[model samples]
Target: MIGGCAPIDAGGSGGGGSDGGARGDGGGSTGVNPLDNPKGTERGLGVIKSAKDLAEAIKIIEKVPTKGRGPKTGYDRDEFGYAWADNAEEIPLAHNGCDTRNDILARDGEKLKYRSGSNCVLVSMTLDDPYTSKTIEWTKQDASEVQIDHVMPLSYDWQMGASRWSRSKRVQIANDPLNLMPVDGSANSSKGDSGPATWLPPAKGIRCSYVVRFAQVALKYDLPVTAPDKDAMLTQCR
Candidate 1:
């Protein structure tokens, strides 16, 4: 849950390479090439349209093993950690005073506005949403308009083998920037823990990027995906 309702600090350039803009097909200004931001420390999920890069994305997807999605029994959002907790250890931007949600907001959004006297609390910003290829000007009043998505949704993580991981490990994956993106709220809600096999971004240009991020998350945690998910991921690039 968000706290601290205060005046915004006005616009400023945010970290995370958002200033690079959407350097991909179609004309818009948001996102960066996923290949360039391999560690996931940067901002925005850029489109991958090059034939050579698409092939590379395919190879990355192929490296992940396949498995049937396990039952969602006893799964809860709290299993990983509290909502946007900043205490998650070993993940980028964690323990950085700002919560995960705000950290990503500053990372991905441009012309960032922070809460009064605090650089860590985001009050407003503009975004070029990769999932829908649209621009959004957002503020605290309608916070839900932008939601941070787990590239590999948490429940999907449990089904993929995170259930067996220790609490700290789970927290790490949960808060890791590499596994997260701020995107259109409705699109994120529609995803609902579904894998690539069942869902992809509405923006065709970003589909390959979405799956590449999924594969990266999977490979990072040594997690496997459902066979169909892997196949669908491969199909995105080709």
Candidate 2:
């Protein structure tokens, strides 16, 4: 069974009530536990509601080394690996006979329907998108309605010194679940390559969790955020 929230009817209206929205709890066992799910195996981007939790999140954010962004020369998505490559090594859900994209969809999506004769191909599912606080009924036909956001954008990584890393390291950062989120398509587009300073989740409640996830990815990869980005991240928790 899927972890977090129950599957909502696809044909139903847009809003699924606050509880239905993706936050602290959604799918069953995966119910939005960002602090605990450091490896990104959990389903939703769980909320950090308590003051103590918020302070702890801020502590993580403060430790992220800060640096100025570098030029975008010699940076390309292919440097990471084939997009959503199933073969990317040294990360969760790799070599599972499924690409990173579909793996995450199955991990977080509810009432999943796979393509005929293929458990790996997700044709449709419901997403309580954390970025916009919306429940999206997504189908393969309307693929852009939902997008997998890189918590740390690849370009930002490049600017922050990923350009100097070996190609294999880039691939791990790209496919790492701690760095990815299936969020509303438009929100993802608007967030292109921006750090926390420039863009944040529209859902006010998830900002702390979002920044914490950002910090987690940065720390894991040994990448640093811009000074302003780090400051903005701390603000979210405060």
Candidate 3:
């Protein structure tokens, strides 16, 4: 989570792209498109299908313990030292048969201008930042401002359970679409390595939906959460 809270330009909301728009799949139709209707949000998976479903999920999520599931404090001089990407360059863009960053850039950016279909270097685009409910005007949308933020920050994963993961498995988790989203630069930076207990989206109205997705992602990845943190998520999601 962001180590300190920062006030943001909280006013204004604008619609940028259609949620129903079609996305490229690398192959003809083999890849899954988010618009095809999100499945696997079953009750057993902590998704809210109804009021009762929400209540039930909240109860289960709240009962989850807290201390053993979070990252180690004083991990270094900084609270977020482990949060920054590690071995990013050595990870090799070609390992996945393509670059993971470009794949996400194209997946998350609109009106993307690509180069030779070999890499995801966008010339222009509009970005819908999920965390702040704001549209970032990306003249070049390049790599800096438009970041593929892990919904659950990686450092949090490393300490909780990922420290033991194999390198390839870690890479897969790093690039998994379910855990990634395009977000505003400042918002993503502010979130750092915090979890649901300490941080959340700036758009207050959508907190329930946001927390629901957080729980789903954590559950899917078999990541653990602290008790207070889990309670906070359930309360927010409810």
Candidate 4:
């Protein structure tokens, strides 16, 4: 039951998943509630303006278990299944016929143009990226301009407790929209596997919302962050 939106009935159907992360059209201009967008289907991570909302976000972050990251032994992208697989179980927008990347693009993009005769391939669109606070006019030809970021990177997850998770669960998190975001390619690349302690979105205004999203993913998967990471996350909302 997401907090801010209408009740999401179970077993709703949608198109294929895309590796592209979440995007926005400023639909949530007044501020989007993370509680309401539990499935990450919403356009953006809205600002947490009210004291009550900030406190609620802090409470969620505080609940996450803290631990130091572990070894990277046997870590690989394939460990979580293929990138943007549409069949990952126990996630929104799975097996809808499109890959996860395209699904996200379609979900958050504006003025979208799909490939001829195919609604699945998003050829171009405008993205209001939250990470860098920039609007990107993205096309398939310059696809790397926008990259899908795992809120909790796969390597970070490997170090955290996902090493013990079943392959299916790993795949689920890897493709889950709640754990992904579409941002500037450079920013996403710079964030490779970094926790909040070390990396944050360049956009100061979105930092709080970014950490809240991180906490959301951590809580959903029963994952832990390092003490420093947790502290950093808390500071954003404070």
In candidate 1, the residue pairs with backbone N, CA or C atoms under 3 Å apart (3 or more residues apart, or in different chains) clash, namely: none
TM-score of 4: 0.87
Sort every candidate by lDDT, greatest first.
1, 2, 4, 3
Q: Please give the lDDT score at residue 12 for candidate 3.
A: 18
Order by TM-score, highest first: 1, 2, 4, 3
Which pairs of residues collide in model 2? 3-27, 3-28, 3-29, 4-26, 4-27, 4-28, 5-26, 5-27, 32-46
lDDT of 2 by residue, 1-238 (tens): 2232223222232222122233543321223547777888767676787777777898888889999999999888898889998667789777777778888887778879888777678899988788776878999999999999999999999999999998889999999988889989999999999999999988787888899999999999999999999999999888
- Residue 237, candidate 4: Cα error in Å is 0.5
Question: Per-residue lDDT tens digits of candidate 1, residues 71-152?
Answer: 9997999999898998888777777667788888877888778877886777889888889877889998999999999999
Find the 10 residues in a row with the least total lDDT in model 3.
Answer: 21-30
- lDDT, candidate 2, residue 116? 79
Q: lDDT tens string, model 4, 52-92?
A: 77788799899999988999999999999999998899798
Model 1 steric clash total: 0
After superposition of all CA atoms, the RMSD between model 4 and the true structure is 7.0
| Regions more than 4 Å wrong, model 1 | 1-25
Candidate 4 regions exceeding 4 Å error are 1-31
Clashes of each: 0, 9, 5, 14
